[model samples]
Target: MAATVEYDVMMAPEEPERSEEEREREAETCKEKGNVFYAQKDYNEAYNYYTKAIDWSQKNASYYGNRAATLMMLAKYREALEDAQQSVRLDDTFVKGHHREGKCHLLLGNAMAATRCFQKVVELETKNEQARKELKNAAAVLEYERIAEVDFEKRDFRKVVFCMDRALELAPACHRFKILKAECLALLGRYPDAQSVASDILRMDSTNADALYVRGLCLYYEDCIEKAVQFFVQALKMAPDHQKARLACRNAKALKAKKEEGNQAFKDGNFELAHRLYSEALNIDPNNIKTNAKLYCNRGTVNAKLKNVCKAIEDCTNAVKLDETYIKAYLRRAQCYTDTEQYEEAVRDYEKVYQTESTKEHKQLLKNAQLELKKSKRKDYYKILGVDKNASEDEIKKAYRKRALMHHPDRHSGATTEVQKEEEKKFKEVGEAFTILSDPKKKARYDSGQDLDEDGMNMGDFDANNIFKAFFSGPGGFSFEASGPGNFFFQFG
Candidate 1:
């Protein structure tokens, strides 16, 4: 049996088990295949092959290094970083592995880690001037960014701008830094400057939310409210869950819709509805300057129509205060002052309106206010009540009741609808006159010198609005080509 077996295997020694040399050769063969796929830009296939090579020979640092590069192409940065670190650990002299680790750190916003890697790369290979440059850049950018963060938290936008500018100088192509600069500009109310920065960013990445929002603010500051809203809508569309964009869109739409409703209701003589709609618009976004001003002015009109004399005065005053250059607000306030018998104040407001916009209506209002001023200055309350200053209290009371009965709304059923409101106003005036004349102290106070101007009324101030706010492929494991960094840094997987 031995002789037969020897005869069968006589010419061939048993096939020797693969030695370490063969195992390493097989691993290199796999790694070479991975390299070919990588050169072909087939990153997934390259990654698979590289992983296979690692399985075959885990101690081969070149296999792990090559696999890390493949992972970076696939946008698996965190995993890439892990693999790269492992590669460097196994063979501390691997320059490519250190470079990849640095790139991964840079992408993840770990400037300190990135600087350390680059510094080590320079240390390992003294002739690597590119790595040396990267080290300095990372260190400088990290320091400036740290300072910018501190200033930003303090709301010191100027300081933030200063720090961000220094950072941008070091890494001019950083998209995140550009975005931060634009935001700081916006917070400082530098819309035009922010827009310029945002425009540059948009040219690089059109769908960037920070750029879109800053552009919208620019348009809004320019009084292009509708266009601004459209930009915000685009921002929201691009980032569906962006709360800031959502709020901007909602506020803009509500302002537009509510103002339209108020305008229509006012046109239809629905003063109550107009007032409510205007108020709702203001409540929705109290800081929208134009919308806030418009709602105030429009509500003032409604207040006047509904005979809310004091409320009308308050609304119109707020409207004008909010926007000194708003012609309509000044005109509305003038009218309110006239209704409240503040003829001097009315003339002052009308004069401002007349200076900017001269229309037939404004001219008539100016003349009327001037005439009322003359009458108000010499106003006689006892004569207004048809009573002599020396008339007995009984005589004054009887005279007021007679005049009140004649002008009373309830007694004016025969009057046209148009005249009935006027008659009710007259009735109230008659009652007011009666009360003033009947009260000895008030009558004496009025007769002495002053009109009853301060009736324990106070108007609150108007609320103002405060409005305002990557990748490329390249060397190393990461591409810095300025085209677009794929999902590598924030890899989906």
Candidate 2:
């Protein structure tokens, strides 16, 4: 207690509070200093002095107007707009405040609002040439906004870009036109041009959320997904209610997660799960063509693993359609065609692949498809069996049984002679298919494009009727006529 009393005794007297008149004078002096700094292009120092003037005289419209001008010079249009608006609120008849407000509104793409502000400036001072010029620019901006809205809805991106360019010529400082032009350029696949426009805006105003979003879009189109997401996040941070940035960020994150999950599933040999995840990723942003192409190709790989060769081929074809230079899609589709004995189609795809990549692997694939095409001109046992060359023995047997039962001559005895003859021909073909494909040695020779005659087992030597009889025969004498197709059983000994 004694130490506290001794400290209080040594305390100095407080300075007296300044009178309102003194504060007003100090505020005017600070504003004059701000004007000097502003004239010298020292926007930061001008902003600080203007802020000090506003703090000293909170009701002074001129101080706020000066600060608004400094903010505009610093390219902080939104903040400038706030200060400009505050100045107008303090004194509605302040022409300079109204003019600054109009400028901020015009730069921010609020053409209607800017028009009102400039109209007020003209109402207060009829002969303001600068306000008249800004009003004309605002009118041009309105026309551009209208035209751009219509063209953008119709997906006429090129026309939108043209309109934006003209609007920008009238209001060169307008960020809205630049952002719209960049968005249209991205839609038109001019990613570099789009990036250039966005980067220019960012150089002046790094915190412009619309410009950041446009830059993200360009990066996204360029297949820089991670970098695009970063930009989108930054835009969202600057403007929490930015719907485009929010949706894009969500899609980018979901796409990346699904893609990674799909790849993990593929690595784990879970083809079904991988296919589903990849399909989900594709649906996340279907407009992202390059990303969707890779997803389609990945799904095709999963389909191939799942033994869905036709679906795999279809997916790979879609991948190729999305990105014609997708070499993996071409190679995968060619392999699928070759597997399915579509040698002509396989050769075409392989030729396309060879044109892109003249590697030995591609060359060999082309040669193999060409050889298969030549071989395909002859009797195709696998084709007759309705099975692929990679079909297992069990799959071959099942196909043979099904084909034989459907095409057996006895099954069509009630039909006309022409129908009976056709059924008999198909039946014989099925029998011959089973004869070659059911035997591993014969299947190996057939797959190698070798003649069975070289192994002393010519196609002519195999009796289709006898083979059919042996395939369906049971202990005493099984008859296909007595047992309908559905009632047939394997004659297990």
Q: Pick the candidate with the highest TM-score.
A: 2
Give the alpha carbon lDDT tens digit for every residue of 1-493 in model 2: 5655444466688988999999999999999999999999999999999999998999999888989999988878899999999999999999999999999988877889999999999999999999999999999889988999999999999999989988877667777788889988987878899999999989888999999998898788667889999999999999999999998888888888899999999999989899999988988887788888999999999999999999999999999998899999999998899889899999999999899889999899899899889878878888888898799988987898789878877667789989988988888888888988888898788888777788887676667767877876756544643466533343334
lDDT tens per residue, model 1, 98-176: 9989977776556789898998898899899888877877887788888888988887878888877877665555667
**Residue 168 CA error for candidate 1 (Å)?**
4.8
Candidates' RMSD to native:
28.7, 11.3
Task: State every prediction's TM-score relative to the real structure.
Answer: 0.48, 0.57
> lDDT values of the candidates?
0.76, 0.88
RMSD of 2: 11.3
Candidate 1: residue 350 Cα off by (Å): 3.4
**Clash totals for all candidate models:** 8, 0
Q: Evaluated with lDDT, which candidate comes out highest?
A: 2
